[model samples]
Target: MLNMNRPNDVEAYIARAEADAVKIPGLENVRPRGIASAGVIGGGTMGRGIATALLCAEIPVTLIERDPATLERAIAEITSIIERNVTTRRMSADEAARAIKHLTTANEIEALEKSDLVIEAAYETMAVKQDIFSRLDRIARKGAILASNTSYLDVLEIASSTSRPQDVLGMHFFSPAHIMKLLEVVRTSATAPDALATAISVGLRIGKKPVVAGNAYGFIGNRMLAIRRHEAEAIILEGVTPDRVDQVVENFGFRMGPFRMGDLAGLDLGWTRDTSTGATVRERLCEAGRRGQKTGKGFFDYDDQRKPVVSPEAMDIIAGLAADKGIARREWSDDSILDRMVLPMIDEAAKILAEGIAARESDIDVVWLHGYNWPRHTGGPMHYARTLGLDTICARLKAMGRTPSDQLRKLLAAPQERQ
Candidate 1:
């Protein structure tokens, strides 16, 4: 151990000196940049970008796609991304060319057999991921790490499908993985501590800030979005137009309003109920084919500049639907809407911490700041809550006639009960 003799406060100094030894289970032993060449399975937007990120780090990448046509498309997408990087001066022409050359494409799974690390960016389906991992388990070289770039689903379940659970972990990269800086590293119970350490180092090498998360459904960011969506539903049901909701929150700190975000991210993403929350207005919107921007309509219509304008038709629909459901309308008080959206987000943030899904409030905050475009000025969702006082946030929810989920309620009451 390094000397702990240099401080005024004995315990504090000793603890400071031991920081490197204080890592969680899978992260206790790790070194940066181990097994070089990375493998990216699935050539979709996320996969191609991940491959590019690895290449930018000077790590050769083997990007695998099942379809010959999609393989060609993935190559083109990688080329486009590299060109953008070149034009922006983030990379030079020669470096870009070298990176592209280092990127090898394959329609064959066995190509990944040579990679020291492989991230499966395949479809969201559990079975699909299971099939991919089953193949990787047999072919991946010994000691090679296998990771999943799953956005929400349980990483543990995906890791369980692989032969070596210890080397299988979640490497949740944000969309357009090369540009987004957050990479959530998830460790299952069976994950090897050293492997987790390795994953963090890998994240750093590829220019990402990896926040280690405990395994759970939806992990951190997307899981909390449930609370946001719920409040959006309540407000819309309370006679607020989708456009109004989007505008309010967008100004509140979000880069885009939730509904507009829904459109941009594709309403179909939330429409397909992996689990049912009962039929709601959102379902109706989906049925009507009013998926956000790509359809030229969602909560609002987009112009040539992609600047959204209030949709006459969506307003008409919102009013009609409210009337049909006997939901009343009112001139929305802006603070009320802000409280409704943010308080629950705060509550969920607290519960996520209470459940050990996140390592710290900073981890949760960084995820939002980097991946979700949550305002960096606010320091992240949890940090914003801490600054506001959890008790105050919880009370705000109560005053709005909102019933926070049980987890949040327990979280809020626990401290009071403890004190």
Candidate 2:
């Protein structure tokens, strides 16, 4: 029998050769661009950065906010960013001012009547998105493209809200959309070729590298992220310390380890949204009100420097939980922890491609490198997988008894570059 506990060293060579053939499929089948003016809704962090990027591209953008105070705050944030750019000699004072002038704000969505493109940077709730799209269908100009900066949520359902479903698409911009180059342009079956083309063009115009993805829940980046988080949490539940997990990854290449990332981004951010799913094991710590860095507690404690130091409180909690479960604390070897985490990611990537969600491995790699902050020099997750092999991915996954979880099992069952 094959060594299910480790990678298939023989197949790693074959996978590397296959990944080397990765390329961009031509958009020859799609309409390129017919619209010019752009508008963005919501004035949250993502909205502000997206608006700034659009204005920087000199495209007239109406930033829709719910209230005057929000508009003011967004304007202040945009101004602060521009001033910093000027200070760094990235842009002249005159150029910065010019870009700032192109931004217009409104307290209502109806103000976007003249926009050729309107992107909702609002809440990720399905109801809210459907309502917004319904309203936009009534207000937005005919042939105008409608886009969403949603990380997860179904684009097809949002498209269904409008009579012009063909024009609805996803333009998932990473946080601080102005800086991140990767953008996932999700296309539903009803989405028109022209709309997708325009989204890609606009992404490029705003200095983003847009990758076309199929309309799937969470799409490529977030889907991969879900699996990544699952693997991270699983290890912690076993025996590996957060610090140890971080050490193994950082030593391999990542700038920061998984726990540090969870702390900085807030441990409660995803869990709060996932409460009903029961897919996550959050109730234990969350019910105790130990949210994360904001509450000055999480996987680790922080001092004035805000550096992550292992929390005795957390260790106590882990111990109590383990004892309650009658589970012995097994010291996870460094290799076991690293193999379990990384191989699952590669397995997830194979599943991602097989589902036809991401058009190619490069797209998956691009999102990981630019958006999710996966170590860049390694050439993204897919590339990392190729470096390791298809058989190796399968071997490790089988060894760990991981099969994409219920959320992604179908993809693994598909015919693809997996052993």
Per-residue C-alpha lDDT of model 1 across residues 122-223, encoded as one tens digit per residue: 888889898899899999999999999988777778877877898899999997789988888888888887778888888878888777888888788888
Clashing pairs in 2: none
Best by lDDT: 1
Error of 1 at 211 (Å): 0.6
User: In candidate 1, residue 68 scores what lDDT?
Assistant: 84
> What is the C-alpha lDDT profile of model 2 across 310-406, one tens digit per residue?
8877777766666666666677778778887677776666667767887766667777777777765565676666555556666776777765444
Each candidate's number of clashing pairs is 1, 0
* Model 1, position 189: C-alpha lDDT score: 88
Q: How many backbone clashes does candidate 2 have?
A: 0
